[model samples]
Target: MNKVSMRFLMSMMLIVGGYAFAKAQSAQSLLKEVDSKVKSYKNIAIDFKYALSNEAQGVNQETKGNVVLKGDLYALNLLGTKQIFDGASIYTIVPEDEEVTISAVSDQDENAITPSKMLSFFNDGYIQKMDITQKVNGRTIQYVKLTPMDSNSEVKHTLLGIDTTTKHIYRLIIVQKNDTKITITVNSFKANQPMSANAFVFDESKYADYYINKI
Candidate 1:
């Protein structure tokens, strides 16, 4: 090959290699940024507008509620109804029926420690893979897929809608093994706020009457 032809071929190879390297680096940086932000917040409480659809069962439910999660304690205020997980016990309050069901955490294997379970995600065996970017309400989000390394986990895989500009998790889609999909949208989210210890407690006496269930 002549000198000009050799230089041209080398330049093309360099360009291709540079593009590939940049793409890989970008993905890594985004994942790292996500981890950093999640790690920084130890406790979080947010109000969510949730849409749940069970395709197999043909059931759809929509609910709006305020969720407070502080470390191990948690509570959900929904439609005059409340569900509280006070570390050792689980309490469900229904105002209409004027009843409360209290169950031990050890007995209830499937407890909701998710969005309301305010523990910091360790990001241990979870894998973060990049997906396609899509526009949500005019905000362009980079799709990042998350799969738990442990198969025993209740969650199948979570699709995260990450705001590219703010680099925050706008929404999360959680799919259970039974194919139940729950889309949780953050109506309003605030992080690192000084949550009073009282926030996580369930005021049982506030309700008119409550029932107890052991099992």
Candidate 2:
């Protein structure tokens, strides 16, 4: 082929490649926008309903929980237990057992989803794609599907539904390889709520008679 024809072909290929790159990057861009909106608040409080189901195993459970997050500190109440993270350590209190467990955050635990990571976990280790949009209860929700990059991971895929108008998360559905599915739906979301500096601090005095385990 002549030099002029070769150059023209190469330019056309570059244009096509650039367009494909932009399309793939759109999902991540939307996620980043959601993260920014979430982080803008001084604090966030969320009431969510958690559901787990497995057809083969015949297991289905549903529960309600709440979490408050500020910076790296968080207070979570789930499954009849309260967990507090004060940036340095985690304190887990079980009311029925009247016990409290304290532990330092380890490297392995860093990847665990905390209240702060819930909105931003899709930023890494996943192939994200814009899925579908639906109107529920008069609000439009846009869903983004994420598949784990690691083959050995138990998670099959995750769907994150976001309120398009508010830029807030509406629901999250996680499917596992074992056919187990977990869904979390946000019932209420409040941001910039007044919170004390000691919101995440664990006061040992309150659980005087409870068994204490430190690790």
Q: Report the number of the highest-TM-score candidate.
A: 2
Window of ten residues with lowest summed lDDT in model 1: 113-122
Measured with C-alpha atoms, the lDDT of residue 6 in candidate 1 is 100
- Please, what's the RMSD in Å of model 2? 3.8
Which sections of candidate 2 miss by over 4 Å? 1-23
Q: On residues 8-106, what C-alpha lDDT tens digit does candidate 2 reach at each position?
A: 999999999887677668778889889899879889999999999999999999999999988778999999999998888889999999999998877
Q: Write down the TM-score for model 1.
A: 0.69
Q: On a 0 to 100 scale, what is the lDDT of residue 41 in model 1?
A: 70
Q: List the residue pairs that clash in candidate 2.
A: none
Q: Which residue pairs does candidate 1 place in steric collision?
A: 100-211
* TM-score for each of the candidates: 0.69, 0.88
Shift in Å, residue 131, candidate 2:
0.9
Q: Give lDDT per model, in order.
A: 0.72, 0.90
Residue 14 C-alpha lDDT in model 1: 100
